[model samples]
Target: MLKSRLYELSLFLTAVAIAFSSSEILADNTSFITAIIVFWFFSTLYFRLRVFYKNGNTNIEYGISYDLSFVLFAGPLGLFILETIYRFTVYFYRKWKKIADPNEFFDTFYNIGTFVITNSFVYFLFQHFHSSFQSFPFGYWVLLFILVCISSYISGAIMVLLFGTIGESITFKEGIHFIFKDISFLDYGKVAITNGLLFLFLQEGKWEMIISLFILNYIVNLSFYSKSQSIQNKLERDQFEQMAYTDFLTGVFNRTFMDKKMEELNQTSEKIGIVVADIDKFKRINDSYNHAVGDKVIQHFAATLKGYLSEDDYLFRSGGEEFTLCLRKRDFSETADLINSILRGVEKNSVEVEYNGEKTSIFYTASFGLYFYKINELTSIEKAYIQADELMLQSKQRGKNQVSMVNGLITKELV
Candidate 1:
């Protein structure tokens, strides 16, 4: 906690120093500063779009503000003034709607500081190499523009790395690696194109071209917002579908999913092995203890049974104290050994419950019935289910905790 505070304090002090230095530069370009501020205010009011990206373990939100300011070649002071006005405008709008964010100032200060520092560095480099830069050919301006964009990116990245590593378990190097992994060539291309267009308009001294570009910028930002919303909505729908198919109690597939999967399997001609298992005397445990303990027992049993299944196997909680396992590409002979192992594992495992401040241990067992047939051989899943259930009743009649197999061709009992 102390380290986090220290980092924040350092950030504030650096931002303050940069703000003071940039203000001095702005005083010299008063006419251009006023014109740029007016342009920035309208741009901020018009283009309020944000794109979100997941960076490793963190999520980052980007707005068009930076791109807009960069394209205008807004030096440290102009960039700082533009962002300050934009932030204030947004705060007031939200406040009028009675939804003001308390953290707005913190974000505003950080962003202004980042812009000041990055653009200041770019200005400094340009001044230092102004003589050599003047000697460069017109075609070489592209190379200079690329260098400026890279420097700005690196400067902003340093701030991100510093803050991202605070209160987290990642190193600076790892954070850089993760952040850069998401940065693509397209990002650079966008920056280059915007910078080129801005430069062209400024060279031609065409105010109308600048106005047209501003409109295009707004449209591009709107397109990005629409795309992000569509992606987010699709993800939400997929999540809801997953929840609908999942069992709330044992975290296994529920009856709805089981039925859906069976329907899909019916379309194929391959044979599938089916096993229906039930907890032996499950109602007695509920009567002896309580419903809570009974639920725990069912959960434990379901989890244990699921562990023995292969990748191609599916386990479903079809009903209370009852589960169905569907195996693909496995015959009755192969399933027999697997069923016996599960029966033994259950007999050895016990569920512990607490009642009236006293700890009690409860033991339980399960019965299984296995059957296998080609999809063409079975008329429907209900017919296969009836055959497996009847065989399970026979196992219970012989004695509890056993597997019974009846496939019309072979009848076997395993104890």
Candidate 2:
């Protein structure tokens, strides 16, 4: 935290130094500087693209500002005027709205410093080559592209430095990847072309065209930004919903999702197999070992069951040691065969866990009860589930580790 504050302070001091050195140029081009600052304010207010970082829910937004174009037309003093006034204005506005925390003030200082320094350096770099290459064919556009690339690199380096100061140390390659992860080269190209055109128009005294270009660019960018925001919102909603409906330990659908699916299945006329599976002697496992071992055994058992399921099957961890599987697109015989195969699979598997500083393999088994029937108005999913549960309890009574199912009046048990 101290390092970040000091880094911000250094940037603030350097920007102040640059601003004072160019104070004399500010008065010489008052009208031009005012025009640039006005447009810079407008762009800063409305035209920004949000780039999301992969680390978490953090994002950085950048505007399609006229600052770079101002540097091209009116030099470093123009940038100093634009950034100093515009950023402070935003700072005060955020403060007035009760949104500016203590950190925001420091961020404002950092912004003023970095914008001035980076743009001033870019201005000098362009000027160094401007005179020699101005007469060449397409040299101006080429120079603009080069300027854009170098500025992007500088911006990325500054970001890496900021992360380092904040204790998020990253490799240069990772920093570059983070910078270009969401933003495309085409977006950068558009900025280069837009700023390049703005520069030419400012030179030719066609200020109305600049306003028109700003409006057009804002409209197009707003459309795309709205679309991107919609997609991001949808993704977040899906992730949240998935988390709410998932079992944390087993990574399967939980009881909440199971209830929802059961209601949907109740409304359908399809032949369904509601299978209730419970780990045999789960209490004994916890008593002999620990809850950690019990959880491991449950997870391994759920995984084995999942491996035997088809596309039309949905598995849910409906209780601590109980799971429910909804099986479809299979007849009675096929369902029995699948359940027996799952029983064999569970019997063959063992959960390996570290117990008392020693590697231990705990073998376990499960009992299953399958209620197969076509859904009708008279038969509800809750009723079917209760029937399956009763059959599963019967399996437990019949020495456990077996599947019990009823076909018509005959009750069959598979061990």
Candidate 3:
């Protein structure tokens, strides 16, 4: 999910680069450099998405990349002005300033708007300059270069703000500090290679350098992508293991594991109780709002039971609208109240969820048929289960939303 989002931001930048027709100066640095940068964004996005598919998630260098992109933008006049204002107030007149941090100033809506407007205008300016002044000398391009850098930083910083923290504490000095602090030779190699290729294309007018840079960037991104994918795959495998024992709807253990666990519990203890709990008239809920809402209710109820149960207590999905709990105990009567307490907590829960677009809330009551017994009384685990199951039916028959007991008499407590 995170990678998908990061990729989306890159795509947006690529579109903007295209919109301004920043790739017109085939004879100069503008066209090839613009193409390379756009490619970088797209390739990064592709790598991220690819990683997401092969693995689940990854830790990315958001701050480093954002700061790099911001440096690219900060070279422009817009951030220069903001930085000038920041430098003046924070550094020159540190005593008089209401906001002393450049980061705080950068995060303001005004700075954000300026960044956006200037970025757009700067791209428009580049398209105009590249088209109108493609033959302009390198000595005369310093002003435009500054503008483009600021635009790039604005675009990158805004992108960072969209996905990450941009706080008052994050200053230009801090950003520069981090640029070197976590310096990766890999990134330096990329920068060197990028500039080398661009210089070749511009200074030496070698068309082949463009292709070389493209390949180098792709190869570099691919290496990171493969490493990220391995991490993602590991995360997914762990998630699968978790889900195998968990309910998708309610985030609890599913019925299969619950039943198997009950058998294990029966083996160790002479006294054990199996409570098969079902939500009363559950179909009504699914019919009234939607299955999604019903699912939310189930999830909420399941979570409630899970929250209230002891570590030794185990719960699972028996089926739709049904749950099975293995109540392990040496004395059936002694543990009955504990189960009752958990039931009361479930009754008290209300589920809140969003379905389609609307928010919905629901509360449900459950019927519990608990089979209590000593391990030796029943023939095998299966027979012991059958006996307990029979008693549960008795409880269900007597009341739709109440606990029925076997091997010991117990009263239902309504909380």
State the lDDT at 188 in candidate 1: 56
Question: How do the residues 135-218 of candidate 3 rate in per-residue lDDT, one tens digit apiece?
Answer: 656622543444445544555454444433322245566555433444354544444345434544544545466556556656
Candidate 2 residue lDDT tens string, 346-399: 988888998899999988889999888877677677788888999899999999
TM-score for all models, in order of appearance? 0.70, 0.87, 0.43
Best by lDDT: 2
**lDDT per prediction?**
0.68, 0.79, 0.54
- lDDT, residue 167, model 3: 27
- Count backbone clashes in candidate 2: 0
The local distance difference test score of model 2 is 0.79
Give candidate 3's root-mean-square deviation (CA, Å): 16.5
Superposed by TM-score, candidate 1 places the C-alpha of residue 298 at a distance from the truth, in angstroms, of 4.2
Candidate 2 colliding pairs? none
TM-score of 3: 0.43
Model 2: weakest 10-residue lDDT segment is: 50-59
Model 1 Cα shift for residue 102 (angstroms) = 2.2
What CA RMSD would you report for each candidate? 6.1, 3.8, 16.5
